[model samples]
Target: MSTPRYALYYAPAADSPLWHFGCATLGYDAFTGEDIAFAAPAGCNADRWPQLTAEPRRYGFHATLKAPFELAHGRSEGQLRAFAHQIAAGLSAVPLAGLAIAALGRFIALTPAGPSPALQTLAFDIVQAFEPFRAPLGAADLARRLASPLTPAQRAYLEAYGYPYVGDDFRFHMTLTGSLPQDDVAGTTAALGQAYAAAVPAAPAVIDRLALFRQDSREGRFRLLDSFMLGR
Candidate 1:
């Protein structure tokens, strides 16, 4: 079997309302690697839901802190895990206050209601700190990443960090659906808003830990390997 690729993700606590709701909506649990049973949102076409959510459901419900990457030539998974532990120990949790359902490009996501500089800094720091463990992108991977038109800076970041949407380009989001057709976006957004209303926290959601996720292969589902608490 191939060594799995790993990622650092900001997953909500398993028992939290957000976790339950997000997993139910996406219909997969990254932590447990299980398909969850959930009713379709009110007024939503059940048949269309699986197709709309297919992409995000596969990735589970979490914001990416570090995109998935294979380990460098000389590194082992244990070394990467220790490094992640050290990184988490030196950092503090950031308060993610007032999440709102909003359209992010063609899809919808749970986004912070206001700017959180601390959150941005934490993400940037994680990307930089873990770069040593990340193997450089292969030719095919690089080509696939650049298949879409990217700004010059995004291309540069891709070359430097192996992922385009890192550093200053990173926008924290827990994606709720795959890219929706223009005609379907508005209705889907409203349905999701109503369905997830109870799960939205009235107060701040503390980003207290970083989760390590492992994918058995490029085509496999990512599952939680472990979680390292912040401020340890």
Candidate 2:
């Protein structure tokens, strides 16, 4: 049996419009651990929708803060939970102008419309503050990460944090689809942009809470474990 892994993420409140839009688009509700049907955008292929979104569906809908990691030898889930609460209590919310649908590499996601120094600092701080709870990456995991082409800095970060995209290498994104074929990128982006506009409300986005997510097994979908409001 595979051991459970945990991650820190920023998921909008369950009742919020952005949360509903993301969960609907992915066809899975991380909070409820249930599947919800989503209509394909007018010009998109409904039949291919599942294939395009299969990967992100597993993770559900959230912007990753601390990438998934197994608990360290001495850490218990209770300790981790208390730590998350402590960390959240001292941090203020990070506000954004809003989110924009954008293509990142081959996948599409909701990205911040503009940069926020506070958001970046928050991400980095969590990565370091939670380091003690993260076990070292296994050999197979390390090999898989190294297989990708990474800059010297990213490789260094992988060695240190077990995730290459932390610190300065991180770009906050709530993934909307799996990597698409080069030929499908343009059309997919257009369809996703339109769908996003229709589904999500017009409001400034804020990172107001930190959610703890758990994956029961290697093949299992992640689900919401708990959420702690910031500055509470």
Winner by TM-score: 2
What is the lDDT of every predicted structure here?
0.88, 0.93
Residue-by-residue lDDT tens digits, candidate 1, 95-192 = 86678888888999988888999999999999999999999998988999999899998999899999999878999999989898998788888888
List runs of model 1 lying over 4 Å from the truth: 1-3
Candidate 2 — which residues are off by over 4 angstroms?
Answer: none
Q: What is the number of backbone collisions in each predicted candidate, taken in the order shown?
A: 0, 0
Q: Return model 2's CA RMSD, one decimal.
A: 0.9
- How many angstroms is residue 66 displaced in model 1 relative to the true structure, after the best TM-score fit? 0.7
Task: Kindly report which residue pairs in candidate 1 clash with one another.
Answer: none
Best by lDDT: 2
True-vs-predicted CA distance for residue 184, candidate 2, Å: 1.8
TM-scores for every candidate against the unseen true structure = 0.96, 0.98
lDDT of 2 by residue, 116-158 (tens): 8899999999999999999999999999999999999999999
Q: lDDT, candidate 2, residue 93? A: 94
Clashing pairs in 2: none
